[model samples]
Target: MHKKVKVKPNSKQQKIEEQPDGSLTVHLKSPPVDGKANEELIKLLSDKFDVPKSYIRIKSGLSSRQKLVEIDKEG
Candidate 1:
């Protein structure tokens, strides 16, 4: 499955919110430096979807606040 995620890095708390438009808003405790936010994003998605971190891949926007992610359906 593919998901559109908007990340708010360096947040006081970590959370994931699903919007009415079907996109996701993710708050991460990690900063957006040296892939820390990306790692946190993968871990959060993995836990949320019951999949491994390896099952999620950032398809685009590696350095931007918005990102497109590809998630394996097999889990």
Candidate 2:
């Protein structure tokens, strides 16, 4: 599955909120430096979807707040 995620880095806590439009708002504790926030995002999504970390990939927006993530459930 592919998800549109809006990432808020350097948050006090980590959390994920599902939007009505089938997107996600993710608050991450890690700062957006050296791909830390992206790593955190993949970890969070992995737990939420009951998948391994390797099953998640950031399809786009590597250097932006808005990202497109792909979750390979069959993996």
Query: Which prediction has the highest lDDT against the true structure?
Result: 2
Predictions in order: lDDT: 0.95, 0.96
Q: List the candidates' TM-scores in order.
A: 0.96, 0.98
- Evaluated at residue 43, the lDDT of candidate 2 is 95
Superposition error at 28 for model 2 (Å): 0.2
Tens digit per residue, CA lDDT, model 1, 1-75: 899999999999999999998889999999999999999999999999998888899999999999999999685
Worst 10-residue stretch by lDDT in candidate 1? 66-75
lDDT tens digits by residue: candidate 2, 1-75:
899999999999999999999999999999999999999999999999999999999999999999999999998
Runs in model 1 lying further than 4 Å from the true structure: none
Where's the lowest-lDDT run of ten residues in candidate 2? 34-43
Q: Give the clashing pairs for model 2.
A: none
